[model samples]
Target: MDDVYVELAQMYDKFGISDFSVSFGDSMLKYFDCMYPNETFKKNLDICCGTGTLCGFFKDDGIQTKGVDLSAEMLDVARSKYCDVEFIKCNASEFNDGEVYDFITCTDDALNHITDIEDVKRIVKNANVLLRDGGLFIFDINNFDILTPGEYNKDSFNGYSKLSLVQSRDSDLIKTDVKYYEHDKLIWQKSLFERDYSISKLTQIFNREGFVLDSCSQHFLDEKRSEKWKLIFKKVE
Candidate 1:
């Protein structure tokens, strides 16, 4: 499949998706802190970490940070934005660094983009291998339970860009259409397709990969949007 983020990277930062990532990550990390009281997160790895915004936020908080993504174009943007972050280009399911981290995050429903169940399982296993004992891992997903054919979602980023999505009524696929504008002049347009993963199946994979579900929330920045979910897991084995 073609790399969607790479095509969007040129105009991605203008959309302020980075800000949403940090804000969402703050909520998720706070939940992690509450779940694992007294746990100090010293190192973090953001998987499928686009634009490295969350990693940048982590760096600002004095945490050692690294971000991994498959798209080199996206990494170029991330590196330019946050030079301090150890941005690596590799498939999330196949990423491995010699060092283990105390905290790991995969945000923005990135997991759902993997259409293969085996690859998703590999990503979960990699998380277990990447985290230290009792480390916390947080990730978000677009809920599969309530997903229906023809479901549509859209969001605008302060007049810089607009993203529109529509789900196929015949399959678990989603078609994303994004338009970027510079001073009201259309600059770029792109379309991409993604598949949504079943939440129950993902939980089962997490169990087999040595992770225990620690928390779950449907809130996106205080909005109770049941169609979205963020789950926190702990490495227990």
Candidate 2:
């Protein structure tokens, strides 16, 4: 495991905001329904499924779901809360099993954490190998256009909860600093770094991995430029 991922996994719960999952899950389900209205899938894989939020949602909707993440700590929390679902600790960039999945998802900018474009391409290729024919690949990424110009840096207050976020971008790295406050007291702070890749680059990589682009939608909840754009790809040919 990468040192950064290992460290972040330990503080995953403290820095992670659960509220975001509610809206994210709804959007994901909407896309899933649109793509496969009549199909009934027996097995689903949520790759890089931090805290297994999507897996929990799928289980609640009566689907058999399994989650994979790089962090054992996060998987522990996911397993403890969602006992019905299986959570495996594994790196998304290089994961393989003998079985194929009906659907595979890597959501919430999970792919951005992978530093190398070649690695991203490898992961997509592996995902293609792991999916049954016509299986859907749905994921999202924080738009570089939004983050490069440092538009995500700002302070917002909500009653007793206050949030401050800052972003720094250079040639090879993009770093985000976040601080959470409650009752006017500092609660926690986290620094997250992601490797940057343009949308065009990602699209090309997906194409090379045998995925046909389907749809791309701007993130519905947030209006900020740093918001995510949801993308759906179909395994074809």
Candidate 3:
């Protein structure tokens, strides 16, 4: 499974249809600046930092940043392009360090990649351990309501780039089957699995992990879509 994730991670930036991190990170930085006007974040970490997309944003903001993922191939690409930032290949659910971070982010719905509730608990617990007192943990999840409704299994395109997506939802599992074809040739295909959690269930997990929910907003900073929510959780003192 780890090797498969690594292979997908290596080709993600090249073959994946969406570049959500660029826009998502932009919004997060704005939120961070507005919410923490006087705060200074020296060290930051991006868990499940596939291709280091968000790490680029942190670097642009002059924050000393590091990235970790279970995919060594992904880290290799990130290291080649962003040599200044450190990249660690590790499992999100079991990572630890003697040092803690001032800020941490796990974006692109990476949390959903964990298909088990216990795995989610372990990952969040590890995140808690990696964060300083009062440090922030930011993440996002696809709304199960929208996902289960079968709206995601659609054919869409952005000019020349066409995307064919298939979604399967079960009692506790959500799977996405994606096939990307370009120039009439099949370029990529991947099956991604994630656990389904409501906003309330997510809140419960965060509270149990001793974190405060600062904000939860749906969609790309817009309420109209309301199909996905980005949440910010802060470590308690």
Better of 1 and 2 by TM-score: 1
| lDDT tens per residue, model 1, 67-172 | 9988899899999998767899999888887898998888877877776778888888998889998887788888755766453433555654455444553377
Which residue runs does candidate 3 get wrong by more than 4 Å? 1-7, 15-18, 148-163, 182-188, 219-226
Per-model TM against the reference: 0.85, 0.80, 0.85
Candidate 1: regions farther than 4 A off: 144-169, 179-189, 220-226
TM-score comparison, 2 vs 3, better candidate: 3
Ranking by lDDT: 1, 3, 2
lDDT against the true structure, each candidate: 0.76, 0.72, 0.76
Whole-model lDDT for model 1 versus the true structure? 0.76
- Residue lDDT tens for model 3, 8-76: 554467554226776777777777677888876668888888788789778987888888887778888
Q: For residue 9, give model 2's deviation from the true position in Å.
A: 5.0
Q: Candidate 3's error at 226, in angstroms?
A: 5.3
Candidate 3 at 189: error in angstroms? 3.8
Q: Any idea what lDDT model 3 has?
A: 0.76
For model 2, how does the per-residue alpha-carbon lDDT over 89-150 read when each residue is reduced to its tens digit?
77776777677887787777878877777778878988898888888777778777754554
